[model samples]
Target: MSQPGVLLDRDGTIIVDSGYVGSVDRVEFIDGSIEAIAALNRAGIPVAVVTNQAGVARGYYGIADVEQVHKHMIAEMARHGAHVDLWLFCPYHPDGIVQAFARRSADRKPGPGMALAAAEALDLDLAKSWVVGDSPSDVGLARAVGAKPLHVGPAGSAVDNVDTFADLAAAVRFILGDGELAMVTRDERPVKFPAARFHRADSYGGAYVNELARAFATVDLEQVSRAAKILNDAHDRDAAIFACGNGGSASIANHLQCDHLKGVRNGTGVTARVLSLSTNVELFSAIANDLGYEHVFSYQLQSQARPGDVLITISSSGRSPNIVRAIDWAVANGMHTISLTGFAGGAARRRAHVCLHVDSTNYGIVEDAHQACMHLLAQYVRQSRMTPDAVASQTF
Candidate 1:
């Protein structure tokens, strides 16, 4: 049997949170952190560092910088006889200034991507593991993956309904299941996310634009190709492509209709009959208000879909009842399904024939990825059908 693992958050939990520590010069290990880790090491438990380095996304540093810091951190920990088995970081932030690092990613805190990846690569049991951190996102990560959470710090910093600890030592003691510690419980208010706190015009004005660019970089070319083939085949067979989602996904779905109907037709000489199930506000609202929000997409699919039609559902969580319901109905009716999802991908990851999943927790990051994927699909189709010389001259 694999041993239980310990997932530690980097900043504030093990190291002092100095607001995006950039250089090795800035890294300061919290009191007793080394000793605590060394204790875990002595106990024969594998340890991993799972951190959200927004500095990369915020234009404060690069992935290399993060690695360098980790290198320094690891070396320091080694000097104290503690070894970190893995270091997984989420560099993207939705409000980041760096084009390469900005956007929501599943690797970020509160999402289970980093922890899950570490668990898989390390061959450990998540249900038997423990997550230790300073913020609500840290606790959230543990809960999302079924690991026990040990949130270190004042209870005020935590999200409501989680275990809290005074420091790393206390958390370690609890994880070790010794009599030295007892888990701390808390009754706290939820963390507030004020719009102004994220506004940061000076620090994050074009962060989304950079995030969008970063998101584009993460797109899987093969997945893009698969989606393209599905759409192109549907067009060739004179079948329809229907898209749906809520809010920003709805906007994307609508844009998809426009692009597939006109952009691909005019550019690639192939006509794709496309429609947005989310475009008709009156119809969707009526369905939502009267029947329930979950029934809106399913109602449309049931009414308008035919066998072999393609359904593209865009949602960040991929767990939206309406989106899932739509996919379920489409599959039963012999339609192809493609989903663009984020975070842990929810249930849609398994249900869709093709899933373009962003491993980010930020909604904006996920949407940016989905939007970029859409553009890539359209552009690839437009260019693939055009002569190289002509493709060079055309603006898509």
Candidate 2:
């Protein structure tokens, strides 16, 4: 059976106090919240947002306004380097000022409606999930689903089922444990480093390099082929392919753009429509400034990605919040996702439609293998569609 997971309250738990936050300008994250959530993500625990927005019921804001605010919140978290897997909200209030929202709804706080809905929608094991909030109602709702209810802020009168935390960071630390331990399994096989190499600095470095190389060598060529086929099929249907990564992986995104968009059908004249989300630094920074970083990829996916499009994500650790959020969005929207990852499978792997895993924990090895996979896909596509002249030119 899978382990228990984490659910978070958005307003006061993750973000600081903001009454009925309806604008991006109003959203501010609690200190260490991003790191805490990221740690949870690394541990393969799904992190969701459960919030009560009484503003909707009060007619102070509409559903769209609430969604926009959430988008801003997500964007901010992304900028800060955390990802929210799912967001569940209750807009109803029994004492709502608006007649339309005046009735008592199961989705309202103190009830488990939204949490239950999130459980069903996200395929979560409610019994193993935790809900972190700053209010008694949040605690009650979590307990209703048999989930762990952790309260943030000052120790309140002890509730039977709730655990009190000094802050969000403290709660997250308890839930995620230490960040030093690697979580998730990328490849089924264990990686071995040579003991002799460790004795000599130079030899150890070389051995480390060699081990990485060997790890890259294990990336299945057939899987690359299958991924190429998927991309090709998508191309045939005139669908878009979106790629994302960070740092070195971001470079890989550019490389993939060159290969998939330009190199694939160079001589054969077949063009695969592709875009690398990491390319535009200006837009990224702008969004980070205006919206926040976490939403950089997700917002793009929401705007540019269509149903049946392909999303290819690259990560050595397989635990980037932005990438995971993008994958989550893709999955929710019925888009296909291909994940290239190292270390343990991470959240991205579990959520991906197809995962190309690199077994090694060493980043260099994983990156190398990712590059090789990229090359293999490009070369295979090129060769498959090569004309007589193109083949002849390659022969000599």
Candidate 3:
């Protein structure tokens, strides 16, 4: 039944004991106590509160008043994003004057009845769980139930199997593991390609290109369909679809522009708004000469992109600085970015919201697959826009 641990004691353990804490205003949580409980909850552990209230027997407060205080505790915990699963309290006192509450019951503390009842109700594995309380009686009860007992108070009484804690918060942290609270920071790793290892003999060729094309043909058709729909929607709204790439990938970007803008709307009433960022030699040279090569796409995107427009970048290695910069700019400026890449899934692949990774090391194969992806999306959109009657009437 996936039985997990956590047995807690109320009053001095969870809340500051204010003798008959009947009023909602009197309820207060110990420091870091709520956060520790929340961490246990996140780790899929169940927690229950087992407390003894002698106030009911002393006539200081009734069971209903105790319930009201519990209710207030639950509300306060919720506000702090922490919640307790159950509350089990023993209100009986053996030497009290009230006839109904005077009897010594097994459910009263110093006996493990309350803890046992909580264990049964919560379906807990008692051996794996620990109990936290401020009193020696609380420790005795925990020990009787075969559970770990943590004593939270100044040193005084000697308990055999009890661990001493300063407060409930410290006890909670001890049980959940303290090292998890340390802050962790991460920086993006630089992309490194082994250009020195490769010679002209290992360059892109027919075999490599064919292998890449075959891999591309296996891309999930559903993704292509969805991308095509997004492209078509933008086109219908007169929004631009910008395509970019590096080297062979640049050629694929050019091809994507041709198929999407020319092929898709060849005979249809719809004309797609498409632009290949790899195109325009003059602008590329000017940007490379003035702002440097890495800034070329970023510069163009700054001037052309708008909110809701789409930017698609293709890269075999996926480490192209210009492409990554372009994608970052587009996304930050509220444009959707998609990447098509290969070779261990590079920076661009990770940066793009939707990545079509070609699981191949060969540049030729990756570029070919990328080109096929472009054609597939464009063709799908074209076919989708065609009426059934129009398609049926067309000659083979």
* Best model per lDDT: 1
Candidate 2 positional error at 117, Å: 1.1
lDDT tens digits, residue span 1-396, model 2? 333558788887888876888777788777667756655643446677888888888988888988998888777655433468788888888889988887788887778888877877667888978888888888888878898888888666455656788778778666654343222222123333331113346544544554555466556666666688888788779899999999999999889999887787677687778899999999889877898787889998888999999999999888888899999999999898899999886998788878888867667778888988877777777777787778778731
A best-first ranking of the candidates according to their lDDT comes to 1, 2, 3
- Indicate the worst ten consecutive residues by lDDT in candidate 3: 183-192
Could you tell which candidate, 2 or 3, scores higher by lDDT? 2
Candidate 1 error regions (>4 Å): 1-200, 205-218
What's the TM-score of each model vs. the native?
A: 0.52, 0.51, 0.51
State residue 45's C-alpha deviation in candidate 3, in Å. 2.4
How far is 392's C-alpha from truth in model 1 (Å)? 2.0
Task: After superposing candidate 2 on the true structure, give the runs of residues whose Cα lies further than 4 Å from its correct spot.
Answer: 1-3, 155-161, 178-365, 368-396
lDDT of 1 by residue, 1-396 (tens): 555789999999888998999899999888778767765654456789999988888888888899999999888765544578898999889998888776889889899899989988888899989999988888889999999888888657765676777889777877765664332222211111111123235324343444344344555677777898998788879899999988999999999988888888775678668999998889989999999999999998888999999999999888999999999999999999999988678888789999897755567778878888888887777777788887888888
lDDT of 3 by residue, 1-396 (tens): 425467787877788787777777888776666655654553446688888887888788888999999888887665443568779888889887777798787878778887777778888878878877888878877778888888886566535666787876567657756653321111111111111122233332322333444456445566566676678778778889999987888888899888887887765667778899889999999999998999989899899889999999998888888988998998899888888888777898788878887765656567767877887787767777788886676531
For model 3, state the Cα shift of residue 356 in Å. Answer: 26
Q: Which stretches of candidate 3 lie above 4 Å from their native place?
A: 1-4, 97-99, 155-161, 177-304, 307-396
